[model samples]
Target: MTDMPPLILWFRRDLRLADNPMLAEAAQTGCPLLPVFVLDPETESLGAAARWRLGEALVAFSQALAAKGLRLHLARGAAGEVLERLARATGASGLWWGRLYDAPAVARDSAVKARLRGLGIEAKSFPGHLLHEPFGIQTSGGGGYRVFTPFWNAIRARDPGPARPGPARLRGWDGDPGAGERLADWRLGQAMRRGAAVVARHALIGETAARDRLHDFLHGPVADYPARRDRLDRRACSGLSEPLAWGEIGPREIWHAARSVMEGAQDPGVDSGSDSGAAAFLRQLGWRDFAWHLLYHFPQMGARNWRAEWDAFPWRGDSAEAEAWRRGRTGEPVVDAAMRELYATGRMHNRARMIVASYLTKHLLTDWRLGLDWFADCLTDWDPAANALNWQWVAGSGPDAAPFFRIFNPQSQAQKFDPEGRYRDHWLKGVGADDFYAAAPLRWRLDPAAPPPVPLIGLAEGRARALAAWNAGKA
Candidate 1:
C-alpha cells in the first residue's frame, strides 16, 4: 500500500507457515512480502547426514509455498551480508524474522539488526521457536531457575499466550527475486549415500507429513508415552523429534492441540491429562525449554559443561574403545544397536541415548564431551541445549545430575527395555534370527575374550576417581 517496496521475511528455524508470529506479522504489513531463506555458509555447512534431512525439509517447505503461489528464496553466505544484499536487491523497507537463541545465532542476529538499523531498515524478531522466551519465566527470587524442576514449575505457573493460528493467506512482491543455488546443488545427501536413498523410500518428509505424525501419535503412542517411553521395543515414542528439530511442525500448535483434547476430555480411554503419558510427553517439551534457558543464561554451555569443574577430568581420546563406541562396534549389544540406529536413521530413542551415553562415559570411562560431539554431528534432533544438557546429565556433571556411582548396566537396560530383543535384533542382529550381526566399523572392536581393549576401570574405580576429581575440581 505504501510507496516503498515490500518487507523481507527472513526464514531461519521456523520453516513452516503455521502459527508463526513472524510470518503473521509479515502478513500484517500488507506491503509486498519477499520470503527469503538464507543458507549461511557458516551455519548451513552442516554434516552430510544433517544436510540430507535439511534438503528434504526444504523441499517440503518449497512445495508448501508453491501451492500458494509463493516461493522461499534461497541465498548462501554470511547472514548479515547476505541479508543486506537481499534488502538492497528487493528495495525493502524492513526485514522480519523469528528469534533464534543459540550463542552464535544471537551474535549473528545482533550484528544483522545493527546493520539493518544503520540502513534505516527495521529488523524485527518475534517468538515462535520456543514456547517461553529465555527471560520470560523466572523464579521468586527474581532470577532464572538453574535446575529443571524449578524451571518447569515456573513455566507451568505462567500462562503461555495463546498460540497464533496458521497463516490462512499470503501476499507477494510483484517482481521475482533472484534465485540462489538449487536444492540439489547443495549436495547435502552425499555422505549417507545408499542409506539416504533407503530411508527416503519409506520416510515421510515435510510439514504436512509432520502434522500427520503428530495426529497419529496423539491417537496412539502418546496416549501411553509415560508408561512405554522408556521401553526401547515399544512403538510408543512419537518419533516427532526430527520433525520438531527441522521446524516442520511448530511446538505451539502441538501444545494447543494436545491441551484442547485434554481439556475436552474427549476420549475417556485416553491417558490425556490425567495420566503419566500426557505428563511425560509434556515433560519432554519442558526439557526443550529448559535446555534453551540454560543456553541463553550460559552461552558457553554449548561448548562447555554446566558444572565447570568437569572440564579437567582426564579423557582417553581417540582410543580404540572410544572409536569402537563411535562406530557402533562395542561388544555390548544394546550400546552397539543404539549407535547403529543413530547411524542408520539420524535419530536414537530417548532411553537408547542415555544407555549409550552412560556406557561411553561410565563404562568405557571416556570423557562425556567426546560423546557429546559425536551426537552433535549425528542427531537430526541435535539441539545444542538438549544434547549438551542430556550429555552432562548422564556424565554426572550437570546442574541436576545422577551421582557418579550410579552407572547404567547396558545389559540390565537391554533386559528391562528390550525384553523381547526386538530393538537389539532390529539394528544389531537384523529382522530375523537368521540375520547375523554385521561387522562393526573397524574403529572399535572388542572380541568377547578381549579384556575391554583397555582395562575395565571398574565402576567403583571410575566412581572413586570421578568423585575425587569432582572434589578436586575436575569432575
Candidate 2:
C-alpha cells in the first residue's frame, strides 16, 4: 500500500457497497479508507419510524462492512464539525459522500463542502442517491420542468450508464481513527415506542436482502405488476420502497435490472405481459426521481402549497375528525384499513395511500400537511420528496396535481380495489387488526373488540363543501 493519508468516506442514505459511486471511487484510490456515519442534526430530525428503520439499516450495514473486513465508525454532532475533526484525527486527505436533494440537506451539504474545502480537504458528492442529478435535466428555457410527464419523457430513453460493482477489496485506515459514539447511545428508535417491534417484522433490512427482493420481484410479481399493483388484497408490488428509502439499494441498479427483464434477458415465465409490467415499474421509479426534481426546484413543497392559489383554500387543522383519522377510526372501512396498515406495518399500499390522502384532504377537509406529518412519523418507506409530492398530488396543491373536485368516494374505492373486502377485513378484523392493537400506544386505549367508528362526515356533504370552498377560492 502507498504511504498516503486515509480518505474519509462518509455514509448517509447511500449505505450499500454494491453499485455505490463513492465506495467504488474510494476503493480505486489505493489509499486507506475511513468509513464513518455521522448522526448530524439533519439525520436527527428524521421521523420516528424512519429513524428506527435507519438504525436497523446502520446495524446491517456495519455487519456487512465487518464481513468485508472494514468497520463503520459512528459519530454524533453537526456534520461539518464532526467530519472536520475526524479528518484531522485520521490525517485524511479527502471526504466523499452521496448527495441528497431536500432543502435542509442541500443547505447543510453546501456549507459542509465550503468548510471542508477551506481546510484543503477534497470534499466531493456523488450521484448514486438518484438515477440522475436533480438539476441535470431541464426544459428548453434552462429551467426545471414543473410537470412530470415531460420530465419522465426527457429521461426515459437517456441512459444513466451502467451500475458500478462493489470494490473487490478495501484498504482501511490503520492508525487511531479517533473517538466515536456507540450506536446504542443514540437510541434512534426511542421515539417509535411500542410500534417498533411490529414494524420490524415487516422490514427487509440491508443490501443483500434488497438485491434478493429485486431478483424475486423481477422473476415473478413484475409479470403481473401492471395489472395487480393497485389490488389492495394482492402481494403484487416490488416491496422495495423501504430498502430504496435507506439506500440499501440504488435506483440505477433497479432500473438496469428491470431493463434487463424488459429486454428479455431474463425469462419472467411465459407471461407476454411482463414487458408492460416492467415498464410500469420503471415509471414508478421515474416518479421517485420526479419528486426529487420538483423538490430541488421547489424546496417549499413539504411545508407550503406548490400552487400559490391553494393558499386561499380553507384547510381544517387538528380536531376530533383528524384525530379519528389518525387512530384509524374514520368508520370508512377502506380508509380505516389503510391507516391501520400504516400503524401495524409502517407502510401503506400505493392505492390505499391515495385513497386516504384524498379522504383527509378532500373528504375530511384537513390540511394535507397533517396527513404528510403522520406518514412521515409512521412510514418505514417514507421518502421526503415522495411523501410531500404524493400528498400534494392527492390534495391538488402541487404541480400536475389531480383536480381538487375529484374527491374519491371511499366506499366506491373499496368496492373497486378491495372488492372482496379482504384488505379491509384483514386490517379491521383479522391478523392485521391484532397487530395494530398490539402496536398501538396504551394511551390511545384502542380496544380490539371496539366497533368500527361512524363516518366523520357524509361523503356527498364533504365533497360539496370542498367544492364550494374550491369555487370560492377561484372566485
Best candidate (score: TM-score): 2
| Candidate 1 off by > 4 Å | 1-4, 199-204, 266-275, 432-475
lDDT of 2 by residue, 376-413 (tens): 99999999999999999999999999999899999999
lDDT, each prediction: 0.74, 0.90
* Ten-residue region with minimum lDDT total, candidate 2: 266-275
Question: How would you encode candidate 1's per-residue C-alpha lDDT over 1-475 as one tens digit per residue?
Answer: 4355878888776778786888777777667777788888655656655677788888888888777667788888899999998888877889988888888888999999999999999999888787799988777887677888778766643556666665677777767567666877867777656557544543556778888888888777777787888999987877777777777777878776666655564533223234455556766787888888888888887577677666676655668778778776676778877887776666788999999998888777788889988887766666778888888888887878776557787778899999988998787556421121222222334343333223334545655665565556522
Q: How much does candidate 1 score in TM-score?
A: 0.90
Q: Which candidate leads in lDDT? A: 2
Off by over 4 Å in 2: 1-3, 265-275
Write down the TM-score of every candidate: 0.90, 0.97
What TM-score should be assigned to candidate 2?
Answer: 0.97
